[model samples]
Target chain A: MMDPLLHVKNLKKYFPLRKGFLEKEKTYVRAVDDVSFSIRRGNSFGLVGESGSGKTTVARAILRLIEPTEGEVRFEGMDICRSSESEINEMRREMQIIFQDPHSSLNPRKTVFKIVSEPLIIHEGLRGKKLRRRVEELLETVGLKSEHMFRYPHELSGGQKQRVGIARALSLNPKLLILDEPTSALDVSVQAQMLNFLESLQRELDLTYLFISHNLAVIRYTCDTVGVMYLGKIIEMGEAEKVFSMPRHPYTKALVSAVPIPQAEQPETAILLEGDIPSATHIPSGCRFHTRCFEKIGAVCEEREPETYCFPDGSQVNCHLFKSTALDDEAGHGGGSGKPLETKDR
Target chain B: MKPVLEITDLKIEFDTFEGTSHVLDGIHLSLGKKDTLGLVGETGCGKSITAKAILRLLPVPPARLVSGEILFGGEDLLKKSDEEMKEIRGRQIAMVFQDPMTFLNPVFSIEEQLVDVISAHSNRNGSRKEIDRKEAKKKAVALLGEVKIPQPDVRIKSYPHEFSGGMRQRVLIAMALSRSPQVLIADEPTTALDVTIQAQILKLLHELVERHGNSVLLISHDLGVVAKVCRRIAVMYAGSIVENCSTEALFNEPFHPYTQGLLNSILTFSKRKDAAQGIQGGIPDLIHPPSGCRFHPRCSRAMKICEIEKPSPVEAEKNHVVSCHLYPVRKVKSF
Candidate 1:
């Protein structure tokens, strides 16, 4: 009911494969092609995909880190893609990103104090005493000691470095945070700690999260809404519980089944997908997932692209199998058999 | 079941600039013939070091094998001569490294690399008849085909750079299996691959190990992956194997606190009611690790004696051993 904190509509980012200077024909890697999702004020929306599925590109495009090729990204009704540099800079105070790799993201030369206070200094222009106090407070908030403020990035462990990264992201008190594989670089125990910490932080700060990760279990644990991306397209988007429990799309089913569950004497029913994901530059025709889709129904899946079908449970799936049921009812916001109200069909 | 490879009290120390890092402190592991045993641990837990020590791959000057015996085929591998070990390296115990790209030579074609592995393995010892290039190439193609690489004849000619990450891993597997080693040590073989690719690789590895009838020591950080393929699981904490048990027993009821914590930490697909839980602290610095039990510092059920004395391995159940003070020693064993 409260307008979604961050709304991305039909976002696209294409990286061109440059050949010669004189070459007229250009080929593009469709990284984030026609992705649309909305995150509520305090809810976490997870974008789950594999290596080249373009989940990171979506996050980058939303932040205008890499300019989107087309479509609207409305952050609290403000057009982010079309905003001026100064306007975007002002908007950045409310939105922040926690990068995937803590080892490379932080400046090696900068101490924990400098890294955490950079945003505060740049935005609010807080002076020496005020800045030191704020940095110490931020470090303490992320479970680091005041003594850790003087330590360099190299001196910190992987888990400690990640804590500092979190501390830095929380420094600005941003309303929306885009976490791109925040715990993938960490060990399992450390990853759990980070996940719980992020959850607690969200509840305490009422922060909107765009959580991007390839780890399905992490997504299922942390996110309220989930989007399953294949190649570049989001084939499935729904409540995390619904999508994970009863995955509609064939790719979603395979992706879910592929994850090795740590259970005792479980059935070896994991759908081992044949071959690797097709290159984004040469994305498959029609349904991008058709090459490896197990439940693919012949010609239609190969010739024509599928439309987003909204179900009664407010879940949306883009697949030919759900076509018959989708056409029976009218289009609506949440409960409908037809196309979803948020995303376009074309 | 007799062990194909048995390591008892294997202690290894690395002489670094800072100090002597006790990387593998009295590690005990046994891989039975035609069995899959997974060594699961965190980054600095010395899983790789243990694997390297089994093959005697660690540099001598910096790496001092403090005390232990690596028994392979009823002989101590540590006492074996350098030339003798070289012969056994690939022919007896082959290893599949984590990154395929780094392990594979960029300049050579897949055919050349496969041929090199095949010929080098066959032409060792000098007493046997030399294997020709033509015979090696033919065998290489068959090996590739065995790993399910489509149209192996043509693809074998393609360079490593041309192949995808998963395909490169398959090539690595093929190379490791070329010699038909008695033992296969895959150190995080599928860690570099995507989830789907990882699944495929895991399945392929399971099938290959079954077909070849070779023991496998799989080193990985993912419990899910180990649970999927391995029959037995070993949980290592800070250079020491804290728990060793059957996969079913581990999943059903883990004895060691570290093993329980590790299992609880893994985020499973099935929705959990409680919030994600983690161990209290990170893995300790191995250079000056915690005395007695390295995990005692971060352990939830740590007692006063855990700080001073190292608890010996106890047989909690049949084929289930745990090194923790909480579980009193019922039956003491060498490992």
Candidate 2:
């Protein structure tokens, strides 16, 4: 709306593969290829995909944890990718990340106080009483008792440890937070608590989040906007409600269908995608989802790559069925299956 | 129909340096022959402990079942001696753990592992002294086939690491079935697997249990997995069965706040368009859990009565049992 707080344009991250004798550079694994999305200030934008979908790569690239092969990352209208070292350091103070694994993300040897205060010490140059007070305040904000500040990571439960992670992220008082599957490891009850805490924290702190998770349910609930990534590309992107209710992309539909309903009698037949997710190194030509595409739209889906078809409602899908050309051609002659391709086959 | 397994008021405690951590607090469960009971809970809820306690496999000294009756076919397993329990472990109740790699030996071939399991069970039953190695190998291959492992014959000779994570889990399931135990305990069997692989394994397990007419205890953090495989669901909290009901009932009108919270937290594709509502507050410290209701600290509708007194098991409806003070129909019990 007002030039999104963070603008990611054509982000691409490729990991080089080395092979044989002299260790010649082999082919590069295009982890995050031509991915672009922006997050509004204080709004949560979710990135959903399976393990190798490059959702994590996009998060890391935006955080500058892993340098992108090519693209532009603008944070608060400042181009982070091209920023000088001093400028980048200055920008780092306003952005932070909370990793998936709480146990590993935290230093096992360090106490909770040290862990949370580490950020403040490095960025704000506060120590001793001031740092301890700040750390306690952060812990209190995350729903942890002030006394828990002295405990080590191992002493705390999975949920408590995640709280410590959250506290550390907030210690820097950052505007943007990148949460990478923050609740995947916790228990359902605990996961619920964490999600609630995150929502409340976002509200109170007015934080912007680039939430990355394989869990569609969490994303559906927490994010204001949603982006579904397949392989290295964003196949679908739109408002959270629009994307969830009316998913246009076949991959998105399959993903949505895959979520398990607690009480309702699921259809005897699930939209079971055959085979494992293909290796990214050897991506199929054309539509990345062609191999598992249940629609089986035939050769066109596997021959020419589809472009993102933007809808008036702000929803976008990169599928052949929605291509403006196809729609226009069909409308002009009233040929082919003039019907808007049924999203759900069954 | 007689239940294949019944556990009554089971309590497990771990002796740690800090103190005796009361892990499993009076957990009671029952499963009819060929029934699938889904044990759903978050991490450290003691869902896995319930399974381990059934097999008497918990590490002693630090781990001890204070009181409970694990009755399999009317036999009180807790009262049974260590030697007696060993006989029941694989022969009557078999288990498939979460991680296949950790459960499987890397050095040994798949065939060797499966054969060893069969041999061990057979030896316990006093089947034969001179075990036929070749015949055992054939049986192992067949077991592999039963679990739907592709290229079973060739794959049987490969080491555990050679197989993918899903395939290895399938191998473990096959090994558990070799004993043909009346009850199968699978603890987060598909957590490490992909969704497609997880679906396949769930289907395979469902078919195996139905065809064999054996009961299964499916333990997992995922309610979706439970919804697919289990006929009945047991919602555990802080080592206690907070809610137990038929799958349909649990999903339709969950009486327990914890169960409702859990169900709401799980996001399904059908409801992907809707926002997910997660439960508030973290789990209480088990060692020093809340005085009354373990879940009271996080319960949205927690009352002063809930904090002061524990609620007894109330028959909320037909086949639905809940432990919460909110339901006026239920009486509060003192801890």
- Which candidate wins on lDDT? 1
Candidate 2 lDDT, tens digit per residue, A94-184? 9988999998999999999888888788889997888878887888999899889899999898888999999988887899999999989
DockQ of 2: 0.41
Deviation in Å, model 2, residue B58 alpha carbon = 0.8
lDDT of 1 by residue, A229-336 (tens): 998888899889889999888888888888888876867688878977999999988888888888888999998888887876667888888887765653443334
Put down candidate 2 lDDT per residue, B127-200, tens digits, no spaces. Answer: 45755778888899999889888778998999998787878999989988887889999999999876656777
Every model: Cα RMSD to truth: 2.4, 5.1
Query: What does fnat come to for each candidate?
Result: 0.81, 0.49
Minimal lDDT window, size 10, model 2 chain B: B267-276
- Total clashes, candidate 1? 0
Model 2 collision count? 2
- Each candidate's DockQ score against the native complex? 0.76, 0.41
TM-score of chain A of each: 0.95, 0.92
